[model samples]
Target: MSLAPRIVLVHRTTEYEELVARHGTHGQAAFFLASRGRDIEEVAERSRRTRRALDEIAAGIPLTWRQARVERADLDRFLFAPEDVVVVVGQDGLVANVAKYLAGQPVVGIDTDPGRNPGVLVRHRAADAGALIASAVSRAGAVDELTMVEAVADDTQRLLALNEIYLGAAGHQTVRYRLGRDDDRGAVEPQASSGVLVGTGTGASGWLRSVWQERGGGLVLPGATEERLVWFVREAWPSPVTGTSLVAGHLSVGARLQLTVESDRLIAFGDGMEGDAVELVWGQTVRVGVAGVRLRLVG
Candidate 1:
């Protein structure tokens, strides 16, 4: 008989939990929120709903299948097996957080509150998890392959971002770097900018969309499943030492955008998660490209 596939349920901390963790107590959190004219009960209600959804999903799993529950914060330390099916039971950002850690594993995005939260990534309700789990285990579910972006530093430090990768300074200061494309024949342009944004098709609708809109929609981005990626340089400042001509472009499959850091410190972060990132000092070269692995998202 074939072995039962392992199901990994991923979630995030609720507002109430975050408040309590910050303030050290429920009463202190309530007092702090009240001072800010926020009602603690609203957070409480949201937390209660999330708990109910989690309970329903837990109960729906079959007795024969092995199960594991993990929080978004703990995903870096979590070990995901080849046969594991990941189920993210939170907002769309939670799905992005879990996507980088996975390879070819099928993921089911379950929106805890479909009414309040935009279910762009998390499109399914908790009640449908059982059926989805069965389909995933049997490898019978329709999967949407989402492209991902990767940033590899000269030191071999690497990061995989499901949405986009932001490369810039640690503060709101100017970033100095030389930008060049792999296909460019020895031509590189030094640029001084606020930062650089490299986004995959999955991130086209998020940060990339806002940037594209600000530029008068001149550039048409690829779809979420497309293997192509778009990049933009934020607030590029032109000077004798730097240029702004190479500010935006597209990266096809197997193509890479290279940057040589001239500043004292530059940080590279993926999917807007700054806490989990890599730091590149002066004289380091980082390459941003399309990652080989694709996120297998189940509808």
Candidate 2:
């Protein structure tokens, strides 16, 4: 007789008792439980239930708890087995860690964002709670050896979205730059003043906010609906005027035209990531593109 296919269920906390209770004996499987050392009590309780269920399902089957050496190798073992299925239960951070460890595998994450993880099935608690959307966007470019997955929202169909990327300064001050083209390629022109901002639909919310805040916190690009655009300014400054006065001054850009920041401590952040120090001068083209990789997910 052929044995049932194996499934590996990974739980982060003790609350996953219900999960083990329901699906523990449904098939031939193993349970891998771990914790980030954040909540010990929860981990203890969950570990007990998970072990009980696993023991009940398959007598004398191996049960492994969180150990130092179980890092990526253990994850690889689960994936290399064609007869095995890995189910991860945790938040986006935990999901990302597992996905990174598994890299290329027919694995799935439960209750987390599926962004940046290709060829993986992601189920979100938002979907289980009847929310209309269940999707995570990764502005942090592509990783090696992965492909995009089909996404499924709560009570919605599966779909895919393009990757979004961005780069910007860190502080509330303005970093000036010029706009033009590079080798016939449309690029920011040669100039200096405050800072520059480049972003996509996914990154607009993050990098865009810094620029917006420096520009007196008004609507960005008043008449432009372009989702992908870069802003190059020669000068920027934080508003010091009180309430309505600042609003009035912000609405009237006469004062902003003369204000400029002069500091070499400017930093670049992409997808909310603070990058290493790299010299950026006039006419230097910082290329941002829709990476040739796609991320996929399943309900």
Candidate 3:
């Protein structure tokens, strides 16, 4: 007989908890919120709801299965096995954050407040977590294999993104880089732009959508499950040293985007988490392509 699968619960800090941690006390947090005309009771109520949801989900996990709980902030340090079933109980972004850390593990996204926060990723309700967990463990659940984007530097430092990867300067300054692709070798052009955004089909409605809309919607983006990626250059500037012709394009299988850094420093980040990024200096080459792994999101 096979052993029970380990269920890992993932969550994020509540607004009330963050306030208290920053202010050092509940009373101080309340006062700080009041000064900004925000009600502390509302924040407290949200925290209560989150705790209730967490408790209900925990109670539903089978006692026979091994269980573990982790916060989003500590996901990097958390060791996840291939057979683990990850249950994320938070907003949609929490699901995206956890997806990168996983290889092919099944993930169940539980929305704490479904009514207010309708999400594409966090589709399951807290009340249904028990059934979902059981289904996932038995490998009988409906799974959505979502495409992911990956960025690899010259040093072999790789980062996976569920939504998109942003590459540019650390600040709001214009970034200088030589952009090219695997298909077009000698056609590489020097670009000075705000940044470059490499996104997947799952990210079409996110930052990619905004940039696409701004450009008057010329390109047709891929679907959430499509094995393709879209890239857009934000505010590409045309100068004597830089060209803006290669602003946006699509990347299919066997096609990869390459960037040779000409700036003093360029930062690459995934899922809009700028703080957690990889730094690339001058002469470094980074490749963006469709990731080999896909997110097995339980539907």
**Using TM-score as the measure, what is the rank order of every candidate, best first?**
3, 1, 2
Write the residue-wise lDDT of candidate 3 on 1-299 in tens digits: 87678999999999999999999999999999999999899889888889999999999988889999999889889999988999999888888899889989999998887776658888988899999999999899899999999999999989999999999998958989999897996979999998999999888978899999999999999998999999999999998989988899999977899999998999999998887899999999999999999999999
Least accurate stretch of 10 residues (summed lDDT) in model 3? 111-120
Question: What RMSD value applies to candidate 1?
Answer: 1.3
Estimated TM-score for each candidate: 0.96, 0.34, 0.97
Give the alpha-carbon lDDT of every model: 0.90, 0.33, 0.92
Question: What is every candidate's alpha-carbon RMSD to the true fold?
Answer: 1.3, 15.1, 1.1
Q: Any runs in candidate 3 off by more than 4 Å, and if so which? A: none
Clashes of each: 0, 20, 0
lDDT of 2 by residue, 174-257 (tens): 454333322334422333434444332333344455656776765553221222333434243433421111111111111111
Model 3 Cα shift for residue 109 (angstroms): 0.4
